[model samples]
Target: MACSACGSDSAIVCSLSDEYRDYAPADAAVISICTHCLTVDPADATSVDTGREVEPDFSRLSDSVPTRPERAIPLVLAIDLCSSIATNRSAIESLLEEVERAGTDPLLVIDRLRADPDVEPAVDLERRRHQLEQLLY
Candidate 1:
């Protein structure tokens, strides 16, 4: 089956893989994983959030906007997160601004989000951080 996170045609559900690395926990089901993403560390740029099993509880961050992630990589992550969370258009526009902006490393953007208090349970931020790891990185 295709990976819900990266659209890769290599996603597979492993009953033997480490549960600690599972992405989602759909009710009574185990986690699904992709071959490519399962290896990339979330701390790395080319990372896919392999262990996510549920929709992140980002409701608390509905109003906690992240800083504009400029450059290519950061921009991609920001845009992906915005789209995933259905952030307001105005906020998106502001986030796209390149004022004093610079590089595109995914970690930079992840770090920015890490600093934000809205992203509860550090794993939530990691989930979004590598949301596009397959496509971009």
Candidate 2:
């Protein structure tokens, strides 16, 4: 395939090794990218037979595996709380009720300077509701 960005023909068909190893049949098509301009070259690519079989390596399983260390990962969940409240209060109430039932602590972060201090909690709740609405509809 020609370089999508520069339209260069001097491209090499490279195998997506990582993708192939993680998820894909051995006989799946090999995706390639241009080496010169680093653009995806689909035309020059070809299917490769990986020749993988159900052969398990039992040598490495003799010893017990070590426990993995806890790591922090970013997680973002968008909910249409605002839209639910505006369009259907029952749905919003149901979601909140479920959250309460699950005993999950919901953390809400907001720009304090831009919000009124007296009604900061209310504002935050409203803002979150609006964000949820945007995500849903």
Candidate 3:
């Protein structure tokens, strides 16, 4: 794959672990950016270990042991915008509208968006607007 920043042919795929307890997952994929020019090299991306602990199983415990089941919580989608002219507002609004129409909770929507190459300093307002339009309406 070509670098998103410098258009370099070299790139690596990388994996990452979720950091937050709420949104954390077992693992995730990330593209490595060039250290020299800060260019995102998708082809050269590599996975990085986050060292997160794995969930333990307690089904086979002794009869005297006390065990609690994991709680199931509503899903909350996370939206992020890149430098392109786009945002997540429209997507969220459209999602809310769909939920209302379907008479379902917004938690049913499990979609999330993030910057492809990891935008720096955040995307501009115009870009956010465009992103919202593209994602939602």
Candidate 4:
């Protein structure tokens, strides 16, 4: 459905099961937000075709299982670790300096922050570091 505010067809529609505290309606109410203007508006629940919704295929779940299970890292922790590498020298360093810092291994923190330099802000830093290294060479 097109957004009423911006008239943009590129809008995100979400189905809410309950009221969103003076924002969304309750009882499976549909809301649309314009990606352009970022306006949130109530949309007609009937406007969405519920029949087109994809059902989860449980047949794959019964299929072959991997011998080794993959470990999933929490998003918040990943973001925090990335942030520590990105802006910690300017932000967290000052905050950490006040206390009698002890028992904290600097190498451990360095290892984690540098572990996945290909991820996000770390990638940016890694690219810059590579450029600087090239210049030095």
Tens digit of per-residue lDDT, candidate 1, span 28-95: 12233333322111222123345663332222232232232124322332343344443433333333
lDDT of 4 by residue, 35-92 (tens): 4433445777776668776322212211211111110111111222233344433322
Ranking by TM-score: 4, 1, 3, 2
Candidate maximizing TM-score: 4
Better of 2 and 4 by TM-score: 4
Highest lDDT model number:
1
Order of models, best lDDT first: 1, 4, 3, 2
lDDT of 3 by residue, 24-69 (tens): 1222334343322223222222243447533322222111111221
The list of candidate 1 runs beyond 4 A from truth reads 1-102, 118-124
lDDT of 4 at 107: 27
Evaluated at residue 106, the lDDT of candidate 2 is: 23
- Any runs in candidate 2 off by more than 4 Å, and if so which? 17-28, 43-137
Candidate lDDT scores, in order, read 0.35, 0.30, 0.30, 0.34
Please identify model 4 stretches exceeding 4 Å from their true place. 25-28, 51-137
Q: Give me the displacement of residue 120 in model 4, in angstroms.
A: 23
TM-score of each: 0.25, 0.24, 0.24, 0.31
lDDT of 2 by residue, 1-137 (tens): 46555565543332443422222123223433333322332332233334642222211211111111010000001122232345545444444333334443222221221233322121234456455444334
Clashes of 1: 7
